[model samples]
Target: MKKLFIFTAILCFSHANNEMEALYLQNGCNGCHGMYGEGMGASPRLQGVREEVLLRRLKDLQKGKTRSAFGTIMVSFAKALDQNQTIEMAKYLSNLETKVDDERYEIEYTPAGDGGS
Candidate 1:
């Protein structure tokens, strides 16, 4: 029974992680944050950040507040997530072990005046 319970717990955790990853990708977080929340260029690393801090920052972004010169770009993305999703994302990112990788995923950036061309 204990083994069965442990297996079930592991499955649930894995499912949650997968869901969080999908959410992160679907929201284009990896465009700036890297595939593993490692961050890229001007974006700050989200991996290993405190859950509370992430939650606060996410909420701030949702509220249309900017933490940095580039933070205004995050407003729409943060608002795209519901409150529960924001919480889950923060928890997931906080649990990530930061690693640098050569795997390249296209970064999404739109210049201020090019109209996303």
Candidate 2:
């Protein structure tokens, strides 16, 4: 009976994780935040942020408030999620241990004077 309970709990956790991943992708979050919530360019890192902070920011965005110069861009996306989904997303992101491979995203810079055409 204990084993069965453990199995059920694992399944539920896995399902919730999958649901969160689907929501993140479907909402186009990966376009601005990296696939692992590592952040990119103008997007701030979501992983490792406190759940309460994430929730508050998301709620604020949903209400059309801007937290930063680029915050307005998040309003539409935040509005797409209902309250429960916002909470779930915050929890999911906060729990993530973000690991980014810098090499995968590194760009080679060429100085103008270098002249390697």
Candidate 3:
């Protein structure tokens, strides 16, 4: 009976993770953050970020209170999620296994109106 209960708990947890991953993908986050939340070109790594920190940041983005201009785009995406979905995403991403590629992704600046193009 104990083993059966354990198996059921594991199954539910895995199912939740799968749902979170699906939500992330459906929201187009995979286009910027990698499939594993590893992040791409200018997208900050989400995997292994602290849950509380990630939740706070996402909430801020949803509220349009983030200071970075890049966060503007994040706000658009974040706003689509309800509070519960946002919390689930934060928890799922924070627990993801991240390797050495987990570095802060930053976009380099290029001055506008440049004839140098």
Number of the top lDDT candidate: 1
Model 1 regions more than 4 Å off: 98-117
Error of 1 at 62 (Å): 0.5
1-117 in candidate 3: lDDT tens per residue?
999999999998888887786677667786788867888866889989999999998898988987666767778898998988899899999998744332212111222246344
Model 2, C-alpha of 8: deviation from truth (Å): 2.2
TM-score for all models, in order of appearance: 0.76, 0.76, 0.75
Stretches of model 3 off by over 4 angstroms after superposition: 98-117
lDDT per residue as tens, model 1, 70-94: 9888889999999888998899999
Model 3, 84: alpha-carbon shift in Å?
Answer: 1.4
Residue 53, candidate 1: Cα error in Å is 0.8
User: Clash pairs of candidate 1?
Assistant: none
User: Candidate 1: lDDT of 85?
Assistant: 87
Candidate 2 local lDDT, 1-117, one digit each (tens): 999999999898878876786778656787899878889988999998999999998998999998689888989999999988999899989987655655323212222345566
